[model samples]
Target: MSDGKEMRRPGGRSARVRAAVHQATLELLEERRWEEISIPLVAERAGVHQATLYRRWGTMPALLDDVVDEWSSTTAALPDTGTLRGDLEVYAAAVAAPLQDSLVPLILRAVVLEIRPGEPRTPSRAFRERERQLQAMLDRARDRGEQVPTLAELLEVVVAPLYFYALFSVPLPAADAGRLVDRLLGLVGQKA
Candidate 1:
């Protein structure tokens, strides 16, 4: 493993270093706020030099963005259950699974900070891309004769409360979060 070659890819040492750095970043986030995280700290935790982290991620925000992007991409494929409730429950389960990870709540907290007090919040480009993928799953239910709502403005409504509750207090247990997903999915129009 020390050779730094990942069998699945060709990037070798650089890739291994990047993975180690990201893993260290996540480990640190479990114990500190994003603002408190620094390249030097990440390098120290990762056992790499500070120059390595800076060379790879450039800035704190850039590093944070990569971490979030990796998280979003690693999730399992969204389920298609024909019924909106079932489909959403599957989606919720995948989402809720990460909430149990100590690092995840911190990440969620950081995301909330990205919002401004009195402005129309725009989804980050990565988030928008991920949402489009989710929406495509929703569209599949529609194609299968399930009723689907006009989702142009409903994305935030669906996810905001979940994040709010998790970031604030009493993070919803996985089972409870599943129930919330079921309830929220019910609110969306579903075919009989």
Candidate 2:
């Protein structure tokens, strides 16, 4: 006695399956380079049928995109330090800390290079998530009657350099985060 519409349950089988698959993917990523991982390997490690993965993710890039999306969302927590400069410094440091891990750059490269024929290029989920976090911080600054740089300006002046260092496997010292925040605020005619 079932209707045509599919019913979804909260914290049910789908969530459990996704968690298992994501964990397996992360484990594989830690153990090997991105190029060496395959769907069959992930399926076996996750203990889920290969067909389930294929049906859900469609391809390896799609699966990796999902994995990174989840990872970024979980790790990026917005800071409320009562001042935009303080918030930006904390956020920048958080961003730099993860790039110190060896696997992050490899995963980022794979995600950046993934191209689907019919799909128009867009920013990665991690980028969008960062933008969202920045937006919240900017909104708070505005509420406190502080002038803040435009989101694009912040991304270019502050975020780009931090990410560039990570992309090149350069060491990003914690002090650099504070320096970047100072530079961004100074450029926008605000005190750091």
Candidate 3:
């Protein structure tokens, strides 16, 4: 890479606009369902023009998608701590901290409760990204010679609890994550 100080995005100002709109969306989501929120309301709350929202995102689903993406961004990457225990702790923290965020519950509820018969499976891009990230983590564990199980197993054992507790607004027990990793590794050890 060329001593990277000069690369600039084409729409730096628009980034601020996007953040404003996303925040506005979250604020609106706190008070109303997606059906009740509108572009005009979001624009007013964000102090951005309705035309800007339309020009950038074009529709309600699209705008909601962006907001969800930003919120989900926290789950974008998992740390490659050399041990499975360390990795799972990082994962636990990532999943747990967002449960307290004003927006995570709304996003999770919409995904779990608001699906229509013919719509795409999950509108939350972050959920989809998390699946991919989880897979990578599993593969890393296996590559490191840890006795990891399938992604489904990991999900049921670890990720499921993370999401379940968060979605339900329950605080995770401090030892729960560590205990989960212990169970996971024990299963692997037993298998071998």
Candidate 4:
């Protein structure tokens, strides 16, 4: 017990380090392409030793995967507006808002590229979360005797277009969310 070394608390220092690394990763992502990011660069930006990055994340892809997962999980909350159309409108706007951030597309691309078959991927986790939210909204509509499109229909009709525009860097106006919801409702034979 005579050693002069300071012992780190279980979560205190660890949590701070992780947060700094994540923030640094996001900042770097905004300024540079995913391919250009490296562990040493991230370590320098995060003010952590390179060994910390290596020990915590192991590799660049793994670090990027963690970053993407963290970012996706913090996205807009699921909207519950009673009506499916109302829910979709709010959800659409929320989803579209993040695409306006330059870092989002890069993170999305990294998620897509780093996804491995049979692994618990960020996209799969995100999809499952969306599925659960959509299911709840659809169930509510059906219970109220309101006709609603299936989850797949909503994904294809509404979510697909929003994501397509985001990935392609297309300008998605705020009004587009309402229009997208209207288009989905119209396609499913529901009055907008």
The most accurate candidate by lDDT is: 2
Sorting all predicted structures by lDDT, with the top scorer first, yields 2, 4, 3, 1
Tell me which residue pairs clash in candidate 3. none
Name the lDDT of candidate 3: 0.71
Count of backbone collisions within predicted model 3 = 0
Q: Write the per-residue lDDT of candidate 1 for residues 1-192, one digit (tens) a residue.
A: 343443445567667887898899878877776678888998899999897678778877778777777766665456767776677677766666677765557666545554445655776655576678778876887888876654543355445556666677656666766655544555664432
Instruction: Give lDDT: candidate 1, residue 63.
Output: 80
Model 1 off-target regions past 4 Å?
1-10, 80-83, 113-121, 152-158, 188-192
Instruction: Report lDDT (Cα) of residue 70, candidate 1.
Output: 72
Q: What would the TM-score be for candidate 1 when compared with the true structure?
A: 0.78
> TM-score of each candidate?
0.78, 0.76, 0.79, 0.79
Give residue 172's error in model 4 in angstroms.
0.9
lDDT of model 2 at position 3: 26
Query: What is the lDDT of every predicted structure here?
Result: 0.68, 0.78, 0.71, 0.78
lDDT of 3 by residue, 1-192 (tens): 142532455367667888888788778877886678889999999998898799889987777667666655644368888866678777776656656664456677655543445766544455668788888888887888777777777888887776677677575654566666676767777321
Q: How well is each residue in 19-136 modelled by candidate 2, as lDDT tens digits?
A: 9998888778768877888999999999999988999898888888887777666766778999998899888888777766644565566566564456667665566777887888
Q: Give, for candidate 2, the lowest lDDT window spanning 10 residues.
A: 1-10
Query: Per-residue alpha-carbon lDDT of model 4 for 94-172, expressed as tens digits?
Result: 7777666755566666666676777853456555765787788889988988888888888888888877777785747
Residue pair clashes in candidate 1: none
* Number of colliding residue pairs in model 2: 0
